[model samples]
Target chain A: MTSIINVSNLSKTYEGGFQALKSVNLEIKDGEIFALLGPNGAGKTTLISIICGLVNASEGSVTVGGFDIIRDYRQTRALIGLVPQELTTEAFETVRQNVSFTRGLFGKPKNPDLIEKILRDLSLWDKKDERIMNLSGGMKRRLLIAKALSHEPQILFLDEPTAGVDVELRKDMWNVVRDLQTSGVTIILTTHYIEEAEEMADRVGIITGGEIVLVEGKEALMNKLGSKQLTLDLLTPLEKIPESLIAHDLRLDNGGTNLVYTYDSKSDRTGITSLLNDLSANGVKFTDLKTNQSSLEDIFVDLVKQSS
Target chain B: MNLRAIKAIYLFEMSRTMRTLAQSLISPVVSTILYFVVFGSAIGSRIQEIDGVGYGTFIVPGLIMLTVLTQSMSNASFGIYFPRFIGTIYEVLSAPISHLEVIVGYVGAAATKSTILGLIILITAGFFVDLQIAHPFYMFLFLILTSVTFSLFGFIIGIWADNFEKLQIIPLLVITPLTFLGGSFYSVSMLPPFWQTVTLFNPILYLVSGFRWSFFENADVSVGVSLSMIALFLMICVLIVWWIFKTGYRLKD
Candidate 1:
């Protein structure tokens, strides 16, 4: 598969010696939802700003669809849509005007049919004639998406698209994103919400301290780094772990009401049978047992902490 | 620069400016009337005609220019400054619009406002004093030139201003004082040699004198010199605005 975005040795050092982005390399394939997850000031916005040509890169080369972001700015920018984090639209302008004007800015001729499709897809068709300031926050977020998609860009950069929005609005935005992906538009989103990535992203990238620590397929990352925990509700409380159960690496919890056994989910054998046998052999019995898998949030937190 | 985008931005800005029709259009007209009442009628009663024109008529061009200058300056400054204040400037910067398009849209709107106020003041000054139009063509030229020039200057002020206070500083401190001392209500020939020479350095003096000369057949200062000075001042303002847009001073950083 051809990479739509190729970033190499990207670093940004603002004036006054504040280093915002370290040397980072990343490649996002076309028609995929790639999520960049990070803590605040972890260089997520900075990276997006550099890619969108909002801020100058101190040292790096970024190409969108084989065109340099700085050299072929007009062409590269024409192909990319940037939805900034701030809700910065003309308050006095109607929603239709706002979106159409954005398309015109890209030197695109007026296409009313495409605009109607975008507005309807984002659930903003009914509010098209209303002033932007009159719309609620959720409607405004959806309008931002409509504006970004108005020009039919190949690559879309949504910087915290759902930040501070209600859950309903977030779901609406996600649906719009999925629709775009189905239409073969590559999306790069930076978000603090882990569930958003877990629900939508095909590939995940973790940025920490101005560096991209890791990037991998979502399922593969889970299978590779994910852990499984087997918890047993003991029939009786135990003062301590018996000598025979020590080899199983079982943790006693809830005053011996629960016993946890951690194992690699990817391993062919979970060793659960042997662990149960060992626990029973030590005169311990369980009334019920349940197994749980590590979530993306756990993995993300671990990756960020390890890099720091 | 896309013409469509420029038109869209221009129309959008103009609509917002016109929304407050009462404040935007009325305030300047009212203030101009006050200027005519206080400076023209009251002050002219004690002064003699200069260069064969009534004192009231002599000050008419200056008062009109003053209204245009201040209105142009405020309109341009506020147009750019408000976007920054409300964090909407980022929307403009992030859009695919070029810098030239942005400036054209904003400066065009500011010029339109100044021109409107100038015409209003001209119409209103007729009620206070009898005005002359020795060269209506030059009069129109001067009005347009002054409007465009001051609007450009105000565009620079908008870009350099860091806050609301900074936005008001240029018009309040610099443009206002210069207009007062630019031989607005009197002829430069009446002043002493030193003061006359000193007034020559003020750019507003050139604009006012040029505009006033357009109305008088034979004014103290020759119309040719006044036109040349206004042209020179306008060029300087354009260069300053163009440089700011090119270098992205206080904009890109």
Candidate 2:
């Protein structure tokens, strides 16, 4: 797959010698949802801002659709849509007017049909004529997405799109993102919400301390680092692990009513058979057994901790 | 030249002016008429005439200039400043429009509004006093030039200011006082020799004198000098704006 956006060794150092972004490189494939997962102040917005031409990078370069962002700024900017983290919209203008004006700002010819379609898709059609200040916060966020889509940009950058949003709105935003991807628009989103990235992203990039720690397919990343836990409900309570079953790393929980054993799923040999034999040899009995796999959140926390 | 982008910004600004018609248009027009009623009547009755023109008529140019100066600056300053305050300026910054297009659109809309207001005041003055334009062309020339120049100046203030207090500081404290002291209501020549010479340093004097000369063919300073001073100021404003965009000062981090 061809990459629609490329960042080659980009770095940003703000005034007073504060380094916001270290030397970093990334490439986003066309028509895929690439989620940048990072903590606050990890230069997620900085990277997006430089690519959108809102901030200049101190070193290296970026290109959108094969055009250098700084050299062909207008061309690159015209191809990208940015939904900023801030809810910034003209309060006095009606929703329709605000969206239409953004189209004009990109030097795009007026297309009422396109504007209407975008507003409708974002569930803002009914409130098209209402002034923005009158709209609710969720509506306002939808309006921002509508504005970003006004010019039909090929790449969309959503900087913390669902930040501070309620669960319903976040779900709604995820659907909208999926629809955009279905229409062949590349998506790049920055989020601190692990669930959001896990739910939506095709590929995930983890950024920490002004550096990209890892970038991999979401499913692959989860599978490679995932661990499984098996819990056996004891027939009766026990004081401690018996000497016969001491070889297996097991912990008694629930006042010794449950035996919990953790093992890596990726390993060829899980040692489950050996552990079960040892438990039987020790005369330990279990009424029930259940297994759980670690989620992306656990992997993310572990990865960040390891890197730090 | 992205005409569409410029039109987008220009129309957006103009629509804002329309939305605040009472504050942007009516207030200034009403205030200008009050100046005619109070200063033009009371002062005209006593002084009769100054520099061979009726007091009411002589102050007409000054009144219009005062209104135009303040309105143009306030309009342009507020037009740009509000976006920064609301953080909507990022929309324009990230758009495909060039910096020149942004300036032209904003300053153009502001100058257009101020010129309209100035003309309206000129017609309103006709009701209170007999007026004639010695050089009709120069009247409009000075009017448009002043509006555009000051609008540019206001744009600078908008970018330089980080807060509401800073936005109002220049227009209220500096520009207003300078307009008054620059002989907006009276000729600078009326001052004593020493004061008159000192008054020549005031930039506002040239703008008012040149504009007044366009009306009655009378001025405190030569027309050429007045025109050149305005041209010089316009150039300086342009250069400063250019530098602002080039360095991304107060705009990009």
Candidate 3:
């Protein structure tokens, strides 16, 4: 995929000298769901804010669709939509009016059909006439999304999209994001929810301390660093792992009734077969065995810990 | 120029006035009527005329100026302030529209509303007094100029303000006093020489003098100077707004 957004050596320092972003460089591919995973205060919001023009970068530059964000702001901004982390809407305005208002602000002609479709897709059609102040928190969040999509921007930035949402709403949001990607919209989402990234991202970028430590295909990232564990349910309890199997560094669990062996799942040979043969040779018999692989959450936790 | 974007913001702001129609239209009308009864009828009975115009009719322009100036400032200030306070201003900052377009949208709506209110007050004053227009063209001109200028000033106050209290403070402490002392209730010519010189320093005096001159050919200053004062104020406001957008002031922190 071609790069749709280029952020080169971007940095942002607030008036109070808080450095929110530090020399960050990122390229967002066209029509891909790129999830930016970071801990709180990791500058996820700052990075997107600069690209979207909500905040100014202290150094470096950003280009959206080959247009400089500062020099060609109008063109770049016209191509993007942003759902900010905060739930903000005109409290007195009805849902339909607010969304239509946003579309107009983006310099788009009024498109009632398109607005209706977005409302329906977001399950907000029935409540289109309701004042935003009266809507539930979840509905308000959905209205924000509707406003962002009003102009049919080619790129969407969802900053902490699912921060306080329920599981059902999160699922619905994921589906909406997926549909947008299918329609050729490039999506960049900033999330601390590791499972959210696992569920929706095509590519994952790990950011910590204002720097991107890694960016790779989600599958490749998981497979490259992912580890698997083999567990043996022994026929009888053993106080300790046998001397012959000490080299494998096995772990005992459930009062020594279970034995666990860890290995790299993607390595040429999991070293499992030899371990099994050694278990037999040492008379470490087991009634049953099950292998388990670590989740993306594990990989993410380790990466963040290492960076910190 | 993003005319559609400007139109959108204009309509959105106008709709807010519509939602509070009674407050926006009724309050000013009521205040004008009460001022007529108290100052025009009761006071005019004791005193005859300010110049050639009757006491009741003399205050029409001043009354309208008072409301328009205050209304324009308030409408414009709150129009932009509410969005920033609510955090929805992020969309505006992120939108493809230019800063000039934003100023046009917000200040345009505010000025339009106040101009409409000024006219409504003019019509309302007609019921209480016999009003005359010496220069009908200049009447509308001064009315629009005052509204647009103050609206721009109010736009600045809205952006400069960090909190709700700060928003009310400028208009209340700075503007309200100036409007009253600017010869809105009494002509500057009636004041003693020293007091008249002090009143000359109030910028609003130019606006009131010009607007009233349009109605009765009577004024505290020449119509040219009055026009110049309004133009100068407008230019200052325009510069402040330009600086606000240029520096990203309180909006982009």
Best model per TM-score: 3
With candidate 2 superimposed using the best TM-score fit, by how many Å does residue A38's alpha carbon deviate from the native?
Answer: 1.0
User: What CAPRI class is candidate 2?
Assistant: medium
lDDT of 1 at B177: 94
Give me the runs in candidate 1 sitting further than 4 Å from their true place.
Answer: A229-268, A274-292, B217-247
Candidate with best DockQ? 3
- First chain TM-score, candidate 2: 0.84
Better of 1 and 2 by lDDT: 2
Q: Write the per-residue lDDT of candidate 3 for residues B1-253, one digit (tens) a residue.
A: 8899999999999999999999999999999999999999998778778887888898899899999999999999999999999999999999998999999999999999999999999999999999889999999999999999999999999998889998999889998999999988888888899999999899999999999999989889999999999999999999999998887898887
**Which tens-of-lDDT digit does each residue in A61-137 have in candidate 2?**
99999999988889999999999998988899999999999999999999999999888878899999999999998
Assess candidate 2 and give its TM-score to the true structure.
0.91
In terms of lDDT, model 2 sits at 0.91
- What fraction of the reference interface contacts is present in each model, in order? 0.33, 0.81, 0.91
> What C-alpha lDDT, on a 0 to 100 scale, does residue A236 get in candidate 1?
92
Clashes found in each candidate (C-alpha, N, C closer than 3 A): 0, 0, 0
- How big is the positional error of residue A273 in model 2, measured in Å on the Cα after superposition? 0.9
Give the range of the ten consecutive residues with the poorest summed lDDT in model 1 chain A. A219-228
> What does candidate 1's lDDT look like per residue over B73-192, in tens digits?
888888998887666665566666777788788888888888888888889888888887988998899898888888888888888898889989989999999998998878888899
RMSD, one per candidate, in order? 4.2, 3.9, 3.8
